[model samples]
Target: MGSGRRNLKNAAVALLSPIPSIIFYLSLLNHCQRISSTASDGDHSLSLSPLWAWCYYHPLLLANVLFFVNVNVLFWVISHIQSSHWMIDLYWTVIPVMLVHYYATHPLAQYNWWRSKIAISLTWVWGVRLSHNYFRREKWQWGAREDWRFTDMRLQYGKHWWWVSFFAVYVSQQVFLIGVCLPLYVIHSVDEPLNIWDFVAIIACLCGIVVAFSADTQLHDFVSRNQKLKELGKPFVANLDEGLWRYSRHPNYFGEQLWWWGLVIFAWNLGQGWTFIGSFINTMCLAYVTKLVEEWMLKQDYRAEAYRLYQKTTSVWIPWFKSSIGGKDKKA
Candidate 1:
């Protein structure tokens, strides 16, 4: 009976997981394309000049499509060889740099290199910090290195996990990544002088960077210190609900979400209102990650009760909502 139930669960997950979700999103993308197709191509071209002229000749679409396909192929191949789930993450840090660099490379936009520099430099900083954190945690391992959340899904879903990983974990994120990064393409296209949007982006970006960087550092330190205690015959602590964590259950996720949205402000200033989709999709992705992480925590040996209590009191996503403290249980 247990085996039969497992098979059923796996089968259900296979049919209903991220692929269908992404397909629905693709339909949305199609709708967006239809709506946007009515706009004149004259608008897509840089107003600056014809120097970086080729990007207007369908290069952006080609580059995006080709790069998107290549990354998914890498993810699909690497999924089978290494369960590490690192491939998706590696690109998170690496690709934004490429994207901004892509923006900066436009010869027509050379007059506005300052704006591109600001965006690209900020992105590079974020990428470096995040990738370094992952590296320090030794998550780059090749074999038997899947994220705990992914492993939980594998166990619950039974035998079809590889396919699920490809669809849900990998392929689904491609468009979202590019979409959330839409700001990168546009921020470099415009030649506007510094304005309120620039100030907003700068301030928000710094706040986000500090919050995320600090939160990760705190968590890392907490984990490291606890590991040392365990090695010295102390009990392993279950939660690190102090500092920024006291205010939010997922301060790290919160900060990162703000980080991308902050970057979107520049795109909005460029009259690329539709580019808001990029940041929104990424916010949804982060929320999903937060949910899965909490679920995974609940499944741990000594974590169920502690995290249940933590969940009762802590804000799930927002950074500092006082009302969330010691609040009633809210289901994920």
Candidate 2:
């Protein structure tokens, strides 16, 4: 049937989309090997290929180049083919882990071995936790849904969505993803020994993970209870204000920021304080995203009043005491 053929076509597209990026990576590796051999011969001439030279001497630049080819190009192609940009969300959980390993394993990478191990381990923990939450929220379905914001943008862009997504979804991600992972690069690029700041970073990172995990778990349960209420034809709960939700309108966002900023501590400890730029930009972007999310909530007829009250009382990002101005609503 046509449906079967269409499914097959999509599967093929998904499988083949990364071929170009894979080929590019292999070629780059081959070039790097050649350069290593040439350098081992003590030939100090400037006859090296410019691209290979840059990749060899500048790992971060090489990462950006690979990110452009893999995420911006290949991810966009697959998103276009699938008519959904959900893959980016899935990869978001994985890419930081990839970047950390990439920087740690790069031929020119220089860092304390134990520090690199700690960074890699923490990143994997974060990635695995996020990926698990993502899959659970999606009912373990792949590419079945995207972030609601993208859906809204798709409607806003109309026929132009195809191209607009290339920038909005893929291009913007390059900035955010690479920016946020700058700490990993910093950790690998420096040869700093263990210090007290490492302990601080470890505590901060672990706390962030714990907070995010707890908040997400509470949210999941709230959503699940709401779904059951709907299934049983009972009235739905308009807003969640219990647990971490009571203190912060977006504890998960706060926790995510904490995680990144925690990593920034590592970079800062390594004397690369400028690496905070990535986490700062990410926090700014999340602020805008929070605004959009609140606007969306306000637009919903059932939850509008409840969420409005919640917003007035709850801190926006940081978890804190509720405001006294908006008396706790009995309905929420």
Please state the error at residue 144 of candidate 2 in Å. 0.6
Task: Report the lDDT tens digits of candidate 2 across residue range 51-142.
Answer: 66666677788888888988898888877767788878888997898789878877677999998999999999999989989988987656
**Where does candidate 1 have its weakest 10-residue lDDT segment?**
44-53
List, residue by residue over 1-332, the lDDT tens digit for candidate 1.
76566445533432333243235334433544554466476453433234323433443564465455556665566556644564565557776776676556533334256787788889989899887876667533322144666767788877887778777776777777778788888887677887888889878887888888889989999899898998999887788888898788888888888888888888888778788888888788778788778877888868788788788777887876434443553322
How big is the positional error of residue 34 in model 1, measured in Å on the Cα after superposition?
A: 36
| lDDT by candidate, in order shown | 0.69, 0.86
Give the poorly placed runs of model 1, Cα more than 4 Å off. 1-56, 107-111, 139-144, 156-159, 321-332
Q: Which has the greatest TM-score?
A: 2
Off by over 4 Å in 2: 1-50, 326-331
TM-score of each: 0.75, 0.90
